[model samples]
Target: MPRKRACDSCHEKKISCDGGSPRCDWCNHRNLDCTYHRASASSRKRPQPAEFSLQDEIEQRLERLESLLQGLRRTDRGDPSPPAEISDKLPSKSQPPSHGGIFYGSLYFAGCHLGDISSRNGIPIFSDEGRRWVQDRTGEAAALEGGQELSDIDLDFAQNKLSDLALLGGHNSAPPLPTKATAQRCLDIFRASTLQVVFPVVDLSTFQEIIDRAYEETTESTRAMVCVLSFVSFLSLLEPQKTAELLPDVEMYATKAQQLLLLTMAEPTIEGLQAALLLCLYLDFSGQLQAASMLHSLASRSLFMLGGHLKPKPPSGATPDDARLRHLRTLFWLCYFCDKHISLRTGQPHAIADDQCDLALCDDYTGLDFIDLKMDGPSLAQYLPKPLQPSDLGLTIIKSKVFSLLFTPSALKKSDTEILHTVRMLDEELERWRMSVPPSVRPSLSSVSDPADPSLQHEFGMLLIFVRFEYLYLLSAIHRACGRCQAWSVDGGVPNAVRSSLLLSVEASRSTLIYLKVASEMVHRESFWLVIFYPLWASVTLFCNIIYKPSARHAQSDVELVSAVPSLLKKLRARVPTPSEALHLQRLEAFIAELIHLANKAIYKHRPENPTAQDKE
Candidate 1:
């Protein structure tokens, strides 16, 4: 899909967009990056109709201003810029309505329905109704199935007290409250409750039904239904071509939604929360970070992260702040996810898969097969957890079960069965955790630590990372067994010593970087600088050989860097080989470069004969 703003190349040029993808036409032919960003001022200018050009928009505005100037020249003529005339002609929208108030630029005003709640009936209206509705209907809605119980909690005023917030670096923006440390850190929350409302859309035919409903809803029930439906409706509206058309309305409603959520923050339920969550999701898709600040605030809490594992008790005598805790946890996970996205974008602070990586590794052939990985049977078994059927169970309490997989899983069967086994066990363990906890308790759970605990989102993250390594290892081992310098498989490939050399390099770079990062953490900062320099130097060697040479070839530079490609292939032949049902050697990421340089340096430079030389000290 075409991205927001412009192509990467256009962004670097610091110019406006004709809004093309792949690369703007100008940059495409020139062979440049194409990741354009939106300028804040661009929004103030009205979106020109499809046929109208940006240049035309500016000219139109200018012409109007020029006409006003001429009228002023007549001295007695009326004021220009018909805002005053429009204001007069417009009916008084000046209803003395008491707005819920604005926090973070959102305008919070509840109109019409509150039903009996607005009149203050005994039936726990307002927050209660919304929460109940969300709990009651979420699962039946397409894309929102797997809904759990309503988890409204009494506000934890003592814990959420201003003093408490300050100690924890409370929401700075809120007092004005607070934050983005990772994954698309900026939240672009908005309310799509109106413009794009529709019934749940698992398919296409119903999609239009939703849009029609949003435009036609006259009552609260239908409006509520429309709100839920619009959550999906907006996804369609977000297509690249249609995005510009809806951007203004989406922005406005997003602002409105944020205001509504913030103003009604006390005991908010699934409807408002989901609205906020969907808005954040939409903003993320559209790359709208600035206006989505409310997401950062709500998601920062602990509830959203841990609530999936929690279950709520009856309405009367439960913990008051549990729901809020759940809300925060969800935000935390989403933010953390985006954090990784940002980190990858920068391509800095790289981490090679460590020993903790998921099973599926067979170090013998990391390069030629799975990538750069080493799989061991016992290691693959570690992550396996007993499968638990889906339900609300405390993922934190299942520590022992988590440990079960840590010990070699006899049940492990696949060649790289350990990862699969671990996941099976985790299924139950995760379910157990999900079933026991209530949403309100998520924040408290965040403080708890258990390797098996569902609260430790890292457990899952680490699992995925491990899986990547396992595959890398498997791929490399196959390459080594078959023959180096071939694709994954070639009917009669034979192991080439030179090809193995390159494979070894990929491994060495990563292993050493990990060792270095760990080692540096252990030493005095000043002394550690020396250790850090080696990894950098090693990385430079690889870069000079691979990345720099490749770039030079593309740039037609004097360095003649492309010359190194042959050596790289030769080195690859000596390092590892592909061996199996046929063979092949897919490409590798830059981290592999570091591995090769470090491996070759440690092996060939200091002790050329020690082909299997390892850093044992």
Candidate 2:
């Protein structure tokens, strides 16, 4: 009377069955035998209470067996045997303790079971013998049972040597602070540089006072302040005017800054936050992206801890000119900007979630007016652009919105229609932001010749170049979603909307390369590090497009554009001060060269004139 249940094969596989007479859909598709065993009414009525108990017993036995197998495997591979005292306490292989787990701000063992692997407050509690065994394996002494806190564990054990090298700059001792006059000159140079225009993190007056105190009372100088000074000097040396004589000092300052980072990190303060962020930037500029990323996470957490993400509440009597409040707000926005940009560039989740922070832009973010101290032959202001009003911070806010609307995990899962709607909305927002920029620096969708006015170009040229690159980068990122959604339909007929997006993405990549070539002529050596990610991202986009549609009308041109990336990198490499600094560029150039070769090969294979051997046969 009732419909037959799923076939035995489907039931065993835990899949739905069509319950066909001869065979179920799954069984028929797989060409496997299908059978149904009808139960008698008496058999169905009988309860099977022991079934769950039997399953639990089997799982427990399997876990023990798996643990034994892991131990045996380790033994065969010549790893030391577990100590006698805790031999029976070893966890199942599937649930082995993680050595690098962080709980709250302290190190702890993760995935350790209570009875099998005893733990207190998420930190494993090991017997003395077990601790010794862990120490021997991990190369760091383990926490004592019950007596030691997670903080007592050596966190350095979790990090690899590469991280150590990045943090310490391969040096053992701190270098002496540069002479007071030299430090002052470097600081002056920093204020006039494009680095200040782009970042605006440091407060000059406050930092100057710190410098004076460091020199006056040398013993009392904070590690954080020293770290900041070293970084400032390091970045200043990277400016275009730097000579070969100063190259050694550049490396020395960077090394000194990095070596002090650990000491600075031990105590969290606003100065410490600033020092950490400067070090993060240094790491990024030096092409240690992974190290920079790791430091960024720590710096971001530090920002949150210091309440830098929130709008500062001045103590009841505090005035509008309160330097501390202004500094806090400035640092907060800087962190926000760095978080969004890094996430976009690295394809990692942003440390600052838009929903969690007050996204209001402050007027004080522009800080003090740039002063041209004529320490060198000519003031840097005579050559570099005056800082733009509204600054790059406005663009950063737009980037935040872009990441939230287009790139978030939930946003990626949207339907084609939803994605199209979001893309249009974002395009409108981006266009409005671009329009707000001063006409001289406003980025255009199409590639154009250099600005006609040399003065305006000199004043705002770098701004215009970077804005254009970012505009195209964002355009590609937004349209790439539509391109991906339509990629699956390439064999079928692609919708008109998706086809347009794919074309737009390719065009954006083309425009990026064109603009980069133009910008290379005007941009300084110091800014070369900034352009590395752009060309790589753009070239890869073009490479993918050519491969996807090798027979398209523009495919030939796209291949040529992809081919040009390596040369562009070579030209940009010359701008960097040292070979070590250009390592990322070298790697990127080689990778793009390979991509070009593959793309050319793909085009040749797909040409209508070319026939496969099978076609000839």
Candidate 3:
């Protein structure tokens, strides 16, 4: 090594070394990732170039050639590398950058440069014009007195500039591109030599590193975005113990976000908070649910100046930045937790604000615009009351009931017999619901512009959303269940199907797992019924043997009786009638009481030894 460097990112990229500090010169220089601390507790070993031995060079060259050849072969063969690979030599880099002694490649791009090297390695070379554009940016940075360490003010200025640029780019057509013929004329040199290339702007290590650095440097206003994204990127992994270790940083960020909310632009702060939320969701996706949920809870309770909840603070000097907008959209994204928001949640729907919807803070957020809000966060609509017209209330009831049935008696589509029964019951329930809408009061079936417009037929439209979720579940289950090696026959086990090329990828356990995941829906049918159902389903697992045999545990009559409560409640609550119509809740409650008693008595009389069985859990 010529000399030791401060930041790993700088060293790793073989960029010009600057004074070793918390941030490196290159990172400070380029506003690129500059998070690496100089390795501590170890001294930089000085390199005294041992005389270049031919064998060493040969060995290195051979190794590089082998790697490149393998990659090329793989590409041609259409066999992608395993995602688990920690580091594969990028196919786009013709040669490694020279620290002191790597030949890498001597490419011709007027002369060899990073871009040239990239092109040599099969990475797409930006057009010469692109290079010119990049150089212009670098030149502008250079003129800024090599500003490496940015203050919050500097960051704001830079962010504004970038937003302006992005807006400009989005709106203006690239100052008319030179004709392809003319554009091609400038660089006829490497037209045939297809060697230079560069890797993707984001790779696993770099992406992770950006997050790591951002976390280290963030203010409260910026913390949430990083927190949410970190989690989102890491979730649903096979085993995520290592990934979850990243949570402490997120917590730190969350604290900062809270402060930002109280002290600065509430909207920007909220955006970062939203990002933090996404990180929580990713944690869930990766199977670290407890931790994800805990984070969510913290966010909801914390002072992140949540617009939906907070009484507006008096207007301050903080102006909104485009980054804030990006962050808001991002929060909307993170709120998507598998089917819900990953953001820190209060374990409740966002409370609809009591007075005027806070317009100064909020950019008109329609409930419909956030249809997926349920996935990433609470439905903003639910937090606020919808226009409580009779039609609106009726629609809400109808949709809720539809879901109760779809979720009930277990979402077991494997049995066509059960599915048909469920559908028939659903049809009858709908007819009942329709009947409740008396002929005199029912809206006319006139020329409707589009069935997709939920705002018009709000109740019926919302019901469609529930229907879609069920449909998605069904399709995904069917797809997963199609694994020939794991196909379900009448026996409820995998049966062989004619193997197809894609059959190897079918995930049999996926459908079963989905059913298992939403299993509580089968019992209590609340949105969170799955949380309760998990324990019950797990009871059928070997781990449950610590207490009782799975077969015996699941077979208990009490379990069946309890599971029925959700559906019964769903049936009762889903069809909320107007106060005028008088939903005799007392009668419904009494019926439930009778059912529970019968179920309990049946359970009390149940004998495990009896061969006859009627329990349908």
Candidate 4:
């Protein structure tokens, strides 16, 4: 008798089967899907590769059948089947983000989680007593307004996520807290190197006291303090060769610090905020982008919850320590600076809103020496302020406002008119900032030999370059946004609106490249990490134009602009200590090269002109 057809599943399993309609007996008995229907189809399509034997085809067919059966079995067992078209689309959740993706993802992750905390059972409470007092007063007001009061458990859980974690403690392999000597060493290193340069989140004297108190008696907060300093030590002090010796387990240290902070989260203090900031910066520099961003967001929320965002006026007839006030205020702005900086670059939403904050800009930081508090403190603006203020922190605050207004993700959702109006307002503010720069710190007035010339000098010039880099970056970002908004036309070809903005973007890009080229001469790894994304953004803009609109007004200029960026990146990369920087530059160079080749083909196809020879003639 002719062999009865069996399902693919039965055939692959080498089991006898009663070929039921649509399915076989063995598949049905096992509650598995039946592929016996495929047998007749497989027989009709007996075409095999000329090089493959019949056995090879049969083996391949069996293997494929087995795979299909396995998938069907999994589906029967409740596991979702993989997408049929997964080969065409990117595999989701199976691969890590690309390096560029990681960078931008880090920014997004940081922005989103800045204030994330569990609110179950009101377990986590605010760290600041002031916030608790405010909460009580608000609760009383609500009660007076006839609202029901929250239960104590609800209130405690509502406090913060840390309190929730503390209550729901689980064992984690966190590193041991440093001993007194170790903690003190880290504190001293942070105070000497990172404090003044990064922004002193807590006063040195106060942190010293915290450290001393830790030596006397250790607490969770003290342990967190030690961890924070340990991270800062890794960032600013520890020799690269000794990283293994010093930070044997960086992630463990970070986790321990986070846990300790959460455990004592109800009692928010300056030291806690300081520790959080250091840890965030360390995570950032260490390439733990997402973690850093999340931690930053958490610390920022804690600061806001603690009333750190609100500047408290000293009581009447009482002289408060303005130094302490200044330190706290500086910390708030530093947080704002970091949040806004990342948001602007990566097109993420900032953690805090503009209307939520009204604190003054960090005191004019110009001429502030490393050792003395004469020019760095809040009292300086009170006592020896300049008429045309030229301070790094002041510029950062101004840029933060611009970024909030224009560069955020929500900015794209606004109407064209609204975006243009905001851009104009930002442009006006930038111009105002330029005019406000004191001649001492201004790039124009200072002679080449002058000690203050940012271009010619090194020490002070580095800060000056930082300020300029930010200004140029924002300027380019604003115009670039305008270009994007105008780029699209109803006909799908390049429009007049886009063309003008594109040209403006190119000009701004050239100017930015020049600034980088100049800055690359004097500035090294220290400040490069802060503003590395600036040139990358500008280069990307130029590159996009070269590819999409190569036949537009400035094709030659665009090619030159794209070509120059890699050299500038190479210069910057030469001085950077991180291998990632070099890798990033190599990738950027490859991207630029690939795009330039495509752009050349596009230009040749569209215009069909020998413009190079014509220009040379």
Model 4 lDDT, residue 615, Cα:
11
Candidates in order, TM-scores: namely 0.24, 0.65, 0.24, 0.59
Sort the candidates on lDDT, descending order. Answer: 2, 4, 3, 1
> Which candidate achieves the best lDDT against the true structure?
2
Model 1, global lDDT: 0.28
Report the number of backbone clashes for model 2: 0
lDDT of each: 0.28, 0.55, 0.29, 0.48
Worst 10 contiguous positions by lDDT, candidate 2 = 103-112
- Candidate 1 deviant stretches above 4 angstroms: 1-237, 240-248, 289-297, 300-306, 309-617
lDDT digits (tens) for residues 29-90 of candidate 1? 54444443533334566432122121332234234334433433354233222233223321
Candidate 4 lands at a TM-score of: 0.59
Candidate 2 residue pairs that clash:
none
What is the C-alpha lDDT profile of model 4 across 1-617, one tens digit per residue?
Answer: 34455555444322345778655665565455665344254356643212212123223423433443344344334223323332121112122222111212111110011111111110111122212222221221111110112335433433643464455355343335566666666655544442344455556656666766554533444554553544544454223333445555454555556666554445676666777877776655543344566778877887887677887665354344665666676677778777876565444567877678865643454433331322343322223332211235556666776666654445534433454456556655665666666654453211223333434453334556666667666666655555423213111223333334334545555566666655677754544445566676566556545434445566666666667766766565433333433333444456556545555554554453533211110
Provide the RMSD of all predictions against the true structure, rounded to 1 decimal.
31.8, 18.8, 33.3, 22.3
Determine which window of 10 residues in candidate 1 has minimal summed lDDT: 103-112
